[model samples]
Target: MRAPEREYDSDPASHAHSQTRTLSSSPPPKTNGYVANGHGSPINGSSKHLKSPVARVELPGSTIYDDSYIDREEYIRLVIQSLRDIGYIESAATLEAESGYVMETSRVAEFRRCILDGTWSEAEGALGHLGVGEDDGLWEAKFLISQQKYLEYLEMGKITMALHVLRNELAPLHMDPELLHPLSSLIMCTDSADLRQKAGWDGAHGSSRRRLLVNLQSYIPSSLMIPPRRFVTLLDQARLHQISHCIYHNAPVTPQHFSLYADHTCDTDLFPRITTTILQVHTDEVWSLEWSHNGKFLASASKDKSVIVWSVGPNSNPDIYVHLHLQDHQFPVGCLAWSLDDTILLSSCEQLIKMWNTESGALIRTIEAHTEPVSALAWVPDGSGFISASQDRKINLWGSDGKQRDSWGITATRIIDLAVTPDYTRLVAIGESAKDPILPPPRSDATAASGANRNGNNNTATSSPRTLEYLMIVYDLTTKQPELSVSLGGQLTSVKISSDSQYALVNHAPDEIHLWDLFTGRLARKYTGQRQGRHIIRSCFGGVDGNFVVSGSEDGNVYVWHRDRAILLDVLTGHGSGSVNSVAWNPRNTQMFASCSDDCTIRLWEPSAGDRDGDSSTRLAHRTADDRSHEGEPNVKGKGRSRESWVEDDSASRSL
Candidate 1:
């Protein structure tokens, strides 16, 4: 027998009493004339109380709410049109029926179907029915349709019919001679392959047919078909423009709320080109260069014992001119550093360190910093003091007041180079360990008889053998204790710490730059392909996120390598016949960087305006060559035209 359905009272008090009575196994509570059914429908009949208990169904916590901000009909219509445009035919049809909004008119649908199926007459009739008269756009659309029909006939081996369609349908339309001539010449094609090759068309099928339909849609009015998302497209373009102009814009703009979708565009031309403006004022080999934090001034030191600071103007007028020439150093300035405030410049020459006010070009202070030549200098993170390393086997910390605050010595070694971490937590030093002293051989008796020896012992001391053990040591600045000491093979020339202080780039002799993990003390990577013999070539890390390492090469080129993969990206030439001493990337600009060479010039590198203006063929060839060169092995020098030749070519073209 079927169980009687249970009903409940509509009043809350009566329902509570009924549940209480059922749970206590007492008689059921009497209900009013009206009772509530399972779906909350009122039933006007006697209640059929259940003899057994019933389980109550709990509703989900989430509730459905109506959106009143946007017009529901317009939004649904747009969604349906988008679905149809993207080929969700069944969903679009169902949505159109349910929403009672027609996304596409019958005439537009017929026109699209005819275009896709190569029914030229039907498609042309539909265009006429939609009021696409013999205007310029309609003519072009008709020409494309007629041309597709001709190609379809040719593919089916209907030569006579194909010729007929071309002469009767296509030739009548006043199209460009360049296009019409090509279509007319396809009549001589005997087979489908010949037509495909000669005409450069895939013969009116698949993507080609779909392309025709899209073209036809463009000529049709929005009232005949579905309108495009013009507002959304414009918003997307504005977002992209803002990002391209603002250097600090790192986050991508995505659709939110009312803006359902948008094409997020970014300027991907991040790498600088080879063509650059060469700053040619320095008289001798440029040794070191640095970009100030604000990117307004570039300070460069040269072997002529002079430092020239160049002021680069704003983008509206990007004129570069010499701002100051500091000639105080008696010897060649080998290194340069700018204070955190960009008001002071520190230059190193031999054992002397000079601090100069950048604006007045006055020497602020001079300190005989070391007993031996100072190899490296770095300012502390807070800019309160600085540190310098010397060949005297010592690392000295000095305050801004020109007083030595603390001094620490590395045992049995002369410091060759040093780099301090950005956080001021540690210091890395590279040097050669000192060897034990050796005594000279005893002098002969004849020399003693001739009284040639000044000493009575008649013996001289000889130099010990050259030390081959190169040491790389890390020290804790807070505790002033040795953290890591490892032996390396070749002589250390230069060292640099990453901005994040996570890795250190150390240049070892004969042509190698090692990337060492600071935390684990493991060799993370090695960048090669640069000539490095006796020259002190410096390597640094820079890029959008410090993903690339750039170094000066003795071969008169700058080599760039990817940090993660250690792959050589480019070997930029044109620094003349001398070694590129230093390469400094602008801290504020990714597209602009500077390279100083022994040729006595600093070249400012940026994206070439001509590159973006080149012809399509030229740009394609350039991009292809770049891609192939960076794929497998590093490109050898002399494989392409030298930068000198490229510059000369550019000059010749400009003359024309």
Candidate 2:
């Protein structure tokens, strides 16, 4: 890598002469190395150099689609979708006409015309397409255009080119939507009904490639070029629609297209192994545990009410969630939180959310926000604010002040858990359903048929729509109304947002956990192996669609469930005589995961040798030092382990 130019920083006077690389000089990558003649193998055993990777501006407040670049309407749609993709809608005040609402109607109309006609050239020529004219706003243009380009790749026939722009062009457009990766991954995709008989993929190619070809809708610019290449674009049944939606991203690298076969060549397959250890580590009875926004600190709220903050170690344990008011909750703290900025620690007793300064351990503010017990709290990613769900049957939005901004009533019998998308657009709640299941009469024919004879043997499994079933509700923060609801029939316990906000997982009561597609509002996959009656604590995802889910169950076991074919990849044991209560992942690390249980223990796991069964093409791994700890190893017993995560404090100690 070339060193940064010292002159650029040291000599302010010479800044004018510094050669600037336009934003990201991220050229479309060739799966095969660049050759002297632009052919294969370089022919000669000579040296070649790729440019040092540049950072993508998609930074905070930079620009999405600036006036300097592309068409207006395309940019506008992208803005809407991007807004939705990022989770901003749920937590943000509606994009006021004030505060730089960049999309003008003229721009919206003209761009729509271009997309309909398949005219990137004409669109490029439009008066307001780029910012050179009177309406120039590069940042706004970037945001808007990138969003449109996303949809276009699928809508138009430019999937290959569209993805090139996203990976090679758009993502860095701004640090990338803080929450897009997660939302993108969470989109609903149904299994592909067709499979190539000859290739087992139905066409002789593969399921992944087929998915890329059909699921999404986007507008492709005729002018933008697809660098010649070939690579894999793997998609299974569960993600057929997802691949289609983001189809633009699946284009091959040309000639030797980048592989996406999910066979020894892809890097997203670690979830199975990682999930196993997480499950094993939570086998004991767990009381509770919490995750840092970056997924570092693992805090467990015990039945004992005392909270233990476990340093994910290695990384500095930023004093997170320390708050003064937290100490005042008279009841055992039922829930705790580390704010998005790593700013405040929030604790819930019955009806209050006490904000405390993690560093000073002083009470900051208290909101009499709920009428009943408060169960979950989430901070908006943009750092705009936060929302909390409570047993009071309400979700409240609170600004820095303890005052409530807005509140929405919930029907979940009680609000048990919550997850806010990174963009803050949607708040997902797992609670009772207005449409719960119906109960059968006491004596049923099914019970008699089950081979158990009773006086009138009746066992009813299917009931009414309003039963106390597990349901996921996508509540629009702006509208404050339930937009969509999905019923998953589990006694919903807890919910979590992936670091990227791609997929949200919920622990269903009685041994089944359901994974939901956040966007389309559908059940994407199902995870098995939860012990009946054990709490299915919570879950976290490493990558956007990184095949694994780590769930802590009440059976005192944390089971790692792999998606697509929802399998119990591994089982982790040890912790409390009770079930595992909570789990978290280091946002910066994919290989490392943490879990805490009622057993009063926190456990961490790493990949064995960090060498798993797959390809190594992309470089997203966070650097980690040696993290081998036999910490929870003895407890990974997976069954009847006496390990406990709860430790009772002496009354004398409490008084002191």
Looking at model 1, residue 140 earns an lDDT score of 86
Highest TM-score scorer: 1
- For model 1, the superposed segments whose C-alpha errors exceed 4 Å read 1-269, 314-318, 410-412, 437-464, 610-656
Q: Where does candidate 1 have its weakest 10-residue lDDT segment?
A: 647-656
- Best by the lDDT measure: 1
Clashes of 2: 140
Clashing pairs counted in every model:
0, 140
Task: State each model's CA lDDT, in order.
Answer: 0.64, 0.47
TM per prediction: 0.52, 0.50
Model 2 residue 317 CA deviation in Å: 13
lDDT of 1 by residue, 592-614 (tens): 67888888778776555433334
Per-residue alpha-carbon lDDT of candidate 2 for residues 451-545, written as tens digits (9 for 90 to 100):
11100111123353233445678778688778887776556777876545657787776677777777666778878886645343666654334
Off by over 4 Å in 2: 1-286, 294-296, 315-328, 409-413, 433-470, 499-502, 534-536, 543-546, 608-656
TM-score, cand. 2:
0.50
